[model samples]
Target chain A: MGSVVMHNVVSVDGFIADADDEVGPLFEWYGNGDVEIGAGCTVSKTSAAYVQPMWADLGVLVIGRHLFDLTNGWEGSPPAGEHVVVVSHRPRPEGWHPEASYFFVDDVARAVAKAGELAGDRTVGVAAGDVGGQALALGLVDEVAMDVVPVVFGSGKRYFGPVDSQHLLEDPHVVVQGDRVLHLRYKVRR
Target chain B: MGSVVMHNVVSVDGFIADADDEVGPLFEWYGNGDVEIGAGCTVSKTSAAYVQPMWADLGVLVIGRHLFDLTNGWEGSPPAGEHVVVVSHRPRPEGWHPEASYFFVDDVARAVAKAGELAGDRTVGVAAGDVGGQALALGLVDEVAMDVVPVVFGSGKRYFGPVDSQHLLEDPHVVVQGDRVLHLRYKVRR
Candidate 1:
């Protein structure tokens, strides 16, 4: 019913976050799109227009329990959309949080299924991390998108979950998002 | 003195080589400048001119022992230059097979020092893997360069080596290498 897409910003070395779990700066390119980056660096205007449509078109978001906990249940407004599903081994929290709407599912397949039901014909965006990798391994993900940041974390959480076997991705749509950020979009070959 | 730079082509998922240790197809974009990548994907001409200077500027290449063994001592010619240093814990092999100039060193610092000596005022490039990561961790690497290929290996060897802590990098020189490859250059902040 809907496509499942995984998206996130990662360093050139594929670190999604630093050891301290700082992801705010990896997304700094989003706030400043017209700054001079470094020598031999140039931003393409085509890359600048990628974000807005992505947010508007996303009808559902499926994330992991860890991400849900890290953001404190998104404090009500998760970046993706109004309908959010968190894949968690634990049951739903007892307290009511008015900040965001979240559906807790124990597994990735169920999360995708629930997200598709909630999204209708729209797209279901899979939040980054181990959840995304699980989706990829399960052949439930349709696309993988990333804003490849210029920073090198040297250590931290990787965007790709460790898959035992190889999973080939179709050639990506590569574009310079900002002066230093590269936006890469790939269709997962199921 | 010479700058020690680490360079490699990696899939968007951060895989440098496949499980079988094959790196040929990950670099296919360098040969085919124009081809339909995947759905809605096309090669950009601006991304085509990124190879020559990278190879010409390298003076010495510092690689790991595993890579040296994999190539059987680079058979004929190493990609970076004639003068190469291999970082290994084992003893030097007996007799040369007439390929490239190779120096075996046990430590990362020694390899960098040797490469610097051999390179003169030129740059010493570090082949990706344990050697590159070791250089980065030791604060000996000056630059980190990568050709971000559009494919996803899902599983394979990563470009980074295990470090005790995180190493942050400065703003990078970003350019489109070829139709589907993005060349990223980062100056390591020592």
Candidate 2:
């Protein structure tokens, strides 16, 4: 089975977006530099070196329904990954990007399991938020990755959702500094 | 005049402590390593190198009334700095540590000014929370320093307090990895 990495670009205050779903400046690093990493994305050379390979190895992405409706499942083509598993109560919208490889599962565990099956040896990337929090609490996520931006969002949608208990992570094994972001990766302590 | 640096050990979620004023695991890094940082504090050598000089240059410490009450103002002997300025409407307790250089000021700005007067050429360290937030909003803070511990506090007393607006910070000039903490410093963008 492939490793599941819960990831997001978070504010210094740990918010992925505001209550209204505005990401604010969280994605600024994607366009802040001259280095291009395909799909119209450009980032600092340090960030490209740190993130490009991760995107290349991503085979499946698991996200919550809110995200699916937000970008219409990234127009049926996720930023990375060949397949997408959306944890939603409703089925995929009828006749919407029928050729795209997208799966809708109501439960988070099943969604991750399906993503794992699709990913094989490739990495499964879980969008950080409610679904990611559930997967992490259930001990399904192997790593936690964050592209930490410097801005502080005092109140917004949290990256970890409403995690009731604390989760310990090993010291970050990867710490890379980019133009306006810091990339950190930590293994989920079992 | 000395620089006013707002500093705190914060959770990945940006909380300095729990609602009940308990730090929980946020202070774990202070005792998790072998390098002694004086005052019976031991931390990773990396952290010591990054934090020791910053502490050595501290001339005054500014804190909110809540923290003053929590630790009784650290029993009139602050962790660092020669003088402590407490922002409180009520005056310091009658004859409480009169021998210690502790000053009581009701307003955050006034407290910072008093701290600066006491600090002179040395740095004025402000404890992050409500008082620090107010000072930053008033444009008194020169830098923001965080010792980010690798744990998520789903909700708690925020490090930035109730900052209603976004504050921009320059990319961190300092990024030091310690045993269980990441030391980061960012200048408050003017």
Best candidate (score: lDDT): 2
**lDDT (10s digit) by residue, model 1, range B100-119:** 58888999999999999999
lDDT of 1: 0.75
Q: Check candidate 2 and list the clashing pairs.
A: none
Per-residue lDDT of candidate 2, residues A43-156 (tens digit): 989999999999999999999999999988888888898999999999999999999999999999999999999999999999998988889888899999999998877778
Recovered fraction of real interface contacts per model: 0.62, 0.66
- Summarize candidate 1's per-residue lDDT along A40-159 as a digit string, tens digits: 223345554676567778899998888888877767576766698989889777775855578889989899899999999888998777888888888888888988776667667878
**Model 2 lDDT, full chain set:** 0.90
Candidate 2 reaches a DockQ of 0.74
Best by DockQ: 2
Q: How far is candidate 1 from the true structure (C-alpha RMSD, Å)?
A: 5.9
- TM-score of each model, in listed order: 0.84, 0.97
